[model samples]
Target: MGAPQHEDVDTVDVDLYDPGDGSIPVFRWRQAGQALATRRQLREMGLRPGGQSPVARIECRGGRRFAWLYRIDLAKPKLPMTLAKELALDKAMAARQTCPKCGRRYHHVLPLKTLGSCLECHDGTPADPASYVTSAPAHRLAA
Candidate 1:
């Protein structure tokens, strides 16, 4: 039998569908061929889509969850983390984890939005010493 024609439905069998109108094919979980991989899968393989558009989609749980599939052959190697990127990310995280009132940087993120400070600074809850750095980092990122 011939492949099924493209339709507007959500789920379609990859093997039985032919995308002649530039529409992306859809496949059930585990049915997408080895040549195709989702973003997370590509990341696990140390690859990125490299600006290529998705060639297909995979759906599971009756189409409630889906991921875009990219051509593995066209994927590029994942970029390595640089020292500057690491420092920048740490600086961003510092803003969230630091307490403005007490100058204490907690190991976990503080309730900055609602309380505007860490638990101890917010209501004198006596935060554990182990939970936060003794003091904020000495150096600050340049504005």
Candidate 2:
């Protein structure tokens, strides 16, 4: 027998989306003057820098355009958005809360309303407890 002939194979266009008259492409790219930084975010996320990267097709309500981030795999485990969100919330609640100044992380044992700042920031100075708990600006923190 010749190499067992399998007649049928699937080939199709997988470009799941249209970038909306190139506006989305321009919006997606963030570069400085003379800086090769269009969509530079892909680099840290272990993706190619050039515009050849493939974005995933995720189901969403309201049809609002948004980006979904994930590591590439031949197949990824699927879950409904509600369950996925619950799992993420549980995991985040379980994380060790960190101190910005001292870089110490401790179990988030206190009640959410009661716990204001990390132990170090709480004891060290009268800075806004909210400040230590803040996230970085969108432009500064990529991927």
Candidate 3:
């Protein structure tokens, strides 16, 4: 129902866990040269964490996971997309639209598991059609 209140969780650990709303919610920003940013924050500035571990974290509401904080000073600029990488991404997206059983490409991704193929190839019979079509019992006349 709530974040676990352990003695160790009281102090925020930049390298381990974030102090949630349960007690301390935010960390102090110190010095003019220091900078901290989340993943999306780095992306907005056209930079990435570049395989560096987070220097800090901010706790989320549900306590599922902490939002990692990266030092903006150490972040690297995002790489430009290459022609080969562009082509590979296009091919992978196309594969998702193609149905393996029917060997056909669909504008929408096919429901492969349930229908096992395209809707046209699927047999549409009900699992128990007879049960659905039973007639009502005839009423008997009383004396």
Candidate 4:
């Protein structure tokens, strides 16, 4: 069987958004390069646009999908990860691992909606001291 022919939906005119007039030009897919870089591309190079606006954009899939492009010359180096930020992230994760009912930290994530507590706390059989006292012998209770 022969491959089906697809209609071209991405036919935006590059002249409409002229790059010469300092305006952001919108090029077709795989066409925005040489002078521009996407966000992921910049990240791969350990660079960022800093605060500069996009120099252009790549539009595709009938203009439904678009990726903003920034000038490589204008991009800045990415900042280093700090110890303070790492510690804060660790604290946030620790809080999520702690069970509310048992006041204990669990290795695995607990189901908040279904269990709502630790496995021991949510079980059908009671495991508390009060339950043991109630189920004591009748003669012991009378004494």
Which candidate leads in TM-score? 1
lDDT of 4 by residue, 1-143 (tens): 77664532344443434554555677787787577889889999989988899877777765666788989889998876586688888777545654566555555565655778656678844444332223332233222
- The 0-to-1 C-alpha lDDT of every candidate, in the order given, reads 0.83, 0.39, 0.58, 0.66
Model 2 is weakest, by summed lDDT over 10 consecutive residues, at: 26-35
The candidates, ranked best first by lDDT, are 1, 4, 3, 2
lDDT, candidate 4, residue 100?
65
Instruction: Give the TM-score of each candidate.
Output: 0.45, 0.21, 0.35, 0.43
Write candidate 3's Cα lDDT for 31-127 as tens digits: 2124878898899998999999877655543333456678898999888658678988767754664545445455565567576665645664332
**lDDT tens per residue, model 2, 8-113:** 1121322335543332322222221222222333444434433334333232232333343222432223335688899897657644454333443344443234
For model 4, what is the alpha-carbon lDDT of residue 60?
A: 75
Whole-model lDDT, model 2: 0.39
- Candidate 3 clashes: the total is 0
List the candidate 2 regions with Cα displacement exceeding 4 Å.
Answer: 1-87, 94-96, 109-116, 124-143
Q: Of the pair 1 and 4, which is ahead by TM-score?
A: 1
When 2 and 4 are scored with TM-score, the better candidate is 4
Candidate 2, clashing residue pairs?
Answer: none
> Comparing 1 and 4 by lDDT, which wins?
1
Prediction 2 TM-score vs. true: 0.21
Q: What lDDT score is found at residue 132 in candidate 4?
A: 23
- What ranges in model 1 sit over 4 Å off? 1-22, 83-143
